[model samples]
Target: MRRRDVDTAVRHAALTFGAAIALMPLLWMVSASFMAPGEASTLPLRALPRRPTLEHYATLFTRLDLARHFLNSVVVTLAATLGSLLVTSLAGYGFAKLRFRGRDAMFRALALALVVPGQVGMLPLFLLLRELGLVNSYLGAMLPFFGSVYAIFLIRQYALSVPDDLLDAARIDGAGELRIFATIVLPLIKPILVTLAAYTFMAAWNDFLWPLIILSDSAKYTLPVALASLVGEHVQDTELMMAGAVVTVLPALGVFLAIQRHYVRGIMAGSVKG
Candidate 1:
């Protein structure tokens, strides 16, 4: 019993250390955001603000017009999450349930496409968007993500465990495929959908490279792109940058926290079902 207790204590200690190491930067970012303008760069490397102030945040909102970028981020993220859910869920259902010639081969091709780097296609995608007159628009920034191979794969894998008999019964009762999917498959896969939404939201929130390339107008810049621009000019404003970081990170964190219980349950249930 003593030996077992010692082993458990060691494991807990190691896990605690790992958790602290991972979270330390985020904790410090929040702490530094509240510090006075020059206080964050002080000699002693303080973790807590000697005096907290929201001046930087005020500067961000009023002076820098960060709210525009914040609104842009929220709109884009929410749109992407909803759009991804609609597309990935339907595509996943088609893959998991629908029978058709070359279905397995088509899925294999999609899986193969994943090995190709996204950047390889960006040049052509940009040209295509330009032709569509979507350049520098929200649609341009969002176009690439309307379908995601990984998201489809995740949903398809989870959806495969749903009983096909339920679907067949609905079909035998003269129900359309859409009705069966909406009534039966969707409820059984709610947890995974929540998980997918969280992931899609976070990705859309943090995406920088594609948005930077597609959106040239400053007014349309997402939060991450706006933050990057801020850093270029405010290199010396450590506290201000940290404040921007806090604003950029908080929404994604909030989203994950809101869905964390569902995410956990989904993975657990999926594992058992699979």
Candidate 2:
């Protein structure tokens, strides 16, 4: 082959191999989830289940109350994502567009605070929640994330592109600040908003440590916490665990896939501006 053709062939081969390697674990998880109980660990490791069954999934819903934890995960993720988006977007827009004393300094301080690890404040936050009687509640699990430093930064970066003349015109027309934000700023920033929503939803859905610490009751456990507890009690049930993994991962994957175009655009916009 010519040199250019050979190079193209090599690159294509490398990409295909890398893709296969990356997908192997996910394929195994899905396969094992369909295997009969104890079939996954037989003398010979089977790449595919000999007799595919939905028994593990049935067990998860019936015995483990997976449905309740699934609902809990959905509720907490949606609430945290929407709440953070609204709060961060409004704050970001105000900082970026509205002139106020000390605004730049405050925004700079908030940006700097992002460097501090969230875990550093866990103990104090937990104690405060306990004092407020918010522990063991979904609100407690989601409270810390209602205002995210990163979300504010992302929204601010996007909101900076909005024209000051638009706001000035709206004000001159007797539009209130909140009304302009609702009708003008929000609609203009829809792509970044969707991107932020997807990101926050994924983070909240996959969060393990905070929810585990705050939610004392099993009934309120999110998917990751519930899956951990399930694994502890049913270590040998590989099929069941795989099924649970599938359930936990699918929603976040779906959400990301659905909004991936906007997410990519938002990231590119922020990077170019920054």
Candidate 3:
């Protein structure tokens, strides 16, 4: 074979191996979810179940009340994602396009905040939420994610690539800032927004710590928190735990898979344009 062709073959082989290695655990989790009780922990470690069963899943929905937790995850993740996109996009556009006093200073201050560990602020934030009587509420669980500094910075960087002249022309034609943003700016920055949506969705969906801390009500628990509770209750029930894992992972995985193309395109576009 030609040298280039030989090199391409090696690279593809390496990538395939790496991909398989990365996916092995997820594949095993799915396979084990279908396994009968005690089958997953068997001596030989079977990749495929000896006998498939839906009993675990049924138990999760019925006895364990996982459906309620799943619904809570869906509601919180969607709300947080939408709110993040709106707030970040608007703030980013204002920073990138609109000139105002102290704008650069404010942006710099926010950028400095990116270096601070999120956990450092959690205690103070929780106390503030308690003062406002927001603790143990969905709003409290979602408040932290609604407008992150990193997300705002990402949007700002991407927004800088938008043409200033286009916005100026809109202003001359009697278009208000909000109208221009809705009609022109949003569509132009759609790729980045979709990327942000994917990021926010996954973050909110998989979040365990904050939700566990804020939501005192068991009925209001998100999937990860509920799954952790499952671990405590069903520690020896490996198959049951796997089933809950599958349930918790599938929606975020599906959302990412569905939007993966747009997600990649957005990242590349930002890297180049920003």
- The prediction achieving the highest lDDT against the true structure is 2
lDDT of 3: 0.89
Arrange candidates by lDDT, descending: 2, 3, 1
Residue-level lDDT tens digits of model 3 in 192-214: 78888887888888888899999
* Local accuracy of candidate 2 as per-residue lDDT tens digits, 140-234: 99988898988898889889999999999999999999999999999998888988887787789999999999999999999999999999999
TM-score of each: 0.90, 0.96, 0.91
lDDT of 1 by residue, 185-243 (tens): 89999878988787777778889999999999999999999999989999999999999
User: In model 1, which runs have C-alpha deviations exceeding 4 angstroms?
Assistant: 1-5, 264-274
Every candidate's CA RMSD? 2.7, 1.3, 2.2
Clashing pairs in 3: none
Q: How many backbone clashes can be found in candidate 3?
A: 0
> Positional deviation of 141 in candidate 2, in angstroms?
0.9
For each candidate, the alpha-carbon lDDT, in order, equals 0.88, 0.91, 0.89
